[model samples]
Target: MSENVLHLENVTMQFGGVVAVNDVSMDVNEGEIVALIGPNGAGKTTVFNVITGVYAPTNGRVSLRGRVIAEDHPRGKMRKMYAAGHLGEYPRSVNNTPDRITRLNMARTFQNIRLFKSMTVFDNVLVAKHMHLKANFFSTALHLNAREERRMREETMELLRIVGLENECDEIATSLPYGQQRRLEIARALSTNPSMLLLDEPAAGMNPQETEDLSAFIREIKDRFGLTVLLIEHDMNLVMDISDRIYVLNFGALIAEGTPAEIQSNPDVITAYLGVAEE
Candidate 1:
């Protein structure tokens, strides 16, 4: 059986009384491409935020490689305010920051493209590479890390080459076409050398052709880097085409999960997306 690369057990996130993600649990096995899909306000991105450490979930645990990386349960003031998921399942809070999570072999892109607009494509990637630097602050400031810097630059170029952005390395990030800007963001995420990648609406603004190209590109990089991916996408065609398994969420709760064929036939999923018909 494939090892589970990521596991969420009874995870929930609440903002005051609003339960954005409620009692959600899912898994992504090593090397599998998993898609999280649902209608608007389904709390898809909320789950992504919880996973990426943008928010410490109000309940349950998030595990990576069988180790619990984040966990918390309703407590203090939250204890009385409409606790969701399993209550008190995790007594301690284990909120790892986003950068710390990235260092621990997880990286993500945003729902909206986030790039260093003032920086060149190469520099944008280089910044991510800085997270793995070995030299101390003093060495970096004194220019003694020159060799390491040079190596990073070379690797950045190689990554750009791999992503077909080599020619645009000198261009300002926001100056690239919309599709390429999206690719650049992914490239920057890749620079972190993650085992798992979380992509938030990667195909949000793409035309059909760009979406198709993105599907192929996602597969290519997955194989090339040996990555396990979890993505949120509304484009059903791309989701169905690329996902090894699909997890459906409605109103922050998982409604269905199965292969593409099974999900396509599921009544709950159909009703969630299209609503009930009058008799």
Candidate 2:
């Protein structure tokens, strides 16, 4: 059997009285391209936030490679006000910071393209490589790790080359076309050398050709880098075309899950997206 890369069990996120994600459970196996899709406000990105440690769930647990990275139970006001699913089952509090999670061999790109606007494309990627540096703080500060720095830059350039951004390396990051900017963001995430990648709306602003190219690129990198991918996307064509399996959500609740063909034919998914018919 394939190894499990990421898992979420009975996960829920409550802000004040608003429950953004409700008792969701999902998993992605190594080498699989899993898609989490739903209509707007279905809590897809909220799920991503919970998974990446941006928000500690009000209840439930998140695991990576059999290691529990985050777990919590309702407390204080929530304990009395909200009916938190799976409460008391996961009593451990292990809320890791985002950087801590990234250091655990996982990386993600944002829904809105976030790049270092003032930095060059090369520099943007080079900065991400610093997380893996072996040199101490003083060695880096004193410039004593010249050899390692050179190797890092070389790897950054090679990464840019692989992502078709080497030609734009010297250009200011914000100066690139919108599609290439998105590509650069993913390339920056890859610089961290993650085995699992979470892409949030990667094709959000792309034209048809760019979207097509992106589908190919996602598959290419998955094979090239041996990556397991989980993505939130609105483009049905792209999702159906690439995903090994899919999970559907509606109103913060998981509605259905199956292969692309199965999701396409699922009545609950169709009703969630299209609404019920009148009598």
Q: In model 1, what are the clashing residue pairs, if there are any?
A: none
**Model 2: per-residue lDDT, tens digit, 169-226?**
9999999999999999999999999999999999998988999999999999999999
lDDT of 1 by residue, 1-279 (tens): 899999999998999999999999999999999999999999999999889899998898999999888998887888899557467568888989988989999999999999999999999999999999999999999999999999999999999999999999999999999999999999999999999999999999999999999999999999999999999999999999999999999999999999999999999999999999989
Q: lDDT of all the models against the reference?
A: 0.94, 0.95
C-alpha lDDT (0 to 100) for residue 273 of candidate 1: 96
Query: For candidate 2, what is the total of clashing residue pairs?
Result: 0
Q: How much is 139 displaced in model 2, in angstroms?
A: 1.7
* Per-residue error (Å), model 2, residue 208: 1.0
Q: Which stretches of candidate 2 lie over 4 Å from their true place?
A: none
